[model samples]
Target: MDLEGLKLETERLLLRPVRGDDFESWAAFCADPETMHFLGGVQPRAIAWRAFLSTVGAWHVQGFSFFSVFERATGDWVGRVGPWQPEGWPGTEVGYSLARHAWGKGYATEAAATCIDWAVDTLGWTDIIQTIDPANTGSQAVARRLGASLRGPGRLPPPYENQPTQIWGQTREQWQVNRLRLRR
Candidate 1:
């Protein structure tokens, strides 16, 4: 499906396609060691540029990719969160990465929940997974908050295959149940 026109908005965020002007923020996010610790370590600006391009390419090639998250109140680029599944990936996934400053405000969970809803409700996915580094407790917590349970070990596709990761996820049915509970 064509995702060029897609835009997902939550109370505090605007989830949309990555734009060329977002490069500086994206590069800075990639270069922050604290933020990149679980995301393949800190990358140089050049590497970050390529990674940014890859996300843009995924939108064209796969019709889905991480959406650039903007804080609605401040109009700031806070991060990226959404569906991601490259060739040989562990599973259809809804992933998230936020700039260091964006942490602790529930932005990750809020944005991820929106993405998860879209993946299941719009994309018709049966299940969604999040491959998180075991040491990244912050992300793990976000996954749990989203109603995902530990689904055991997982491996990244090439280049990142050696990294230790764990899968956390739930079926669409399970998510729907949880989503209802949250509203009540």
Candidate 2:
């Protein structure tokens, strides 16, 4: 996939490719315990920047990477969302998080919906998994809002540290049905 200028625009958020310089703002969000609860734990700024750059670089190499989400009205960085392949998972996963301040505003759902649309419409991906920490009821709610069905337990790497994850899923058939209904 030629991903020169890939961007996904939602009603209240602008989803764009993460650049190297987004370190400071992105790190601030990641550095928080609440925001990073499902994403391992808080990390040093340097580690956070490196992780962000890894996502940026993955965009070129894997044709997809975690996107930086910003509020369109205020132009403030909120969090990240996108498709990823966890170490042992067989299919691609739709992963996301939002700053504590940006919570309850539907930014995560809005951005995640756009990514789901792209996966089904543009990328021809049939099945997408959303792995949420069992304790993260907020994220689980977001997954449900996107029409993803619970698929059972999913495992992840350290930091996650063997926490049991609930896998929510959306198939192409389900997405297509929902998309048509959305259009109507």
Candidate 3:
């Protein structure tokens, strides 16, 4: 897990480590009420900066975090998606968030599926989860598209401990079977 050299590409996206230059788009995403609705509400610019920095710090401390996602054709910062497991997290997770404008294009699924594969194959994770707010139909759709099944209610760690979520996921064995079937 050489964090600096890490990068994952899908047909329409480039997922890589968060960089200083990404703050603008990151802040914009954080400020959007719709985009941040399930992600702790709209954050002020200053707060968003702290959140952005935390993602950068996670890569240094944990060797993995949400990778900043970019549109391949336009080189626009679209969002962040990938492996994440903070202290007290429910499980090893692959999460995604995209700017509002990037929505409806299946970018989350594309980026998340790649991250899930890496977690299972490269990181040797036995299982992975996505803690999604139940009202977030879009994310639930992405989870379903990835072959994850709802495992019932979940809770976030402190600060966000009260927020209700649903755990959706699959075991590595299950993902492998799905992958093989997908290729068929």
The candidate maximizing lDDT is 1
For candidate 2, what's the RMSD? 1.9
Between which residue pairs do clashes occur in model 2?
Answer: none
Off by over 4 Å in 1: 1-4
Clashes of 3: 0
RMSD of each: 1.2, 1.9, 1.2
- Residue 30 local lDDT, model 3: 94
Residue 30 CA displacement from its true place in model 2, Å: 1.3
Per-residue lDDT over 1-184 for candidate 2, one digit per residue giving the tens place of the 0 to 100 score = 6454777887789888888667788889878987787777898988987788789888888778788888999989888888887456647787888889999988887888788788777777889889887888898888887788889887766656477788889798897776665444
Cα lDDT, model 2, residue 73: 93
Candidate 2 lDDT score at position 28: 91
The residue-level lDDT of candidate 3 at 78 comes to 93
TM-score of each candidate structure, all chains considered together: 0.96, 0.91, 0.95
List where candidate 2 sits over 4 angstroms from the true fold: 1-4, 157-161, 180-184
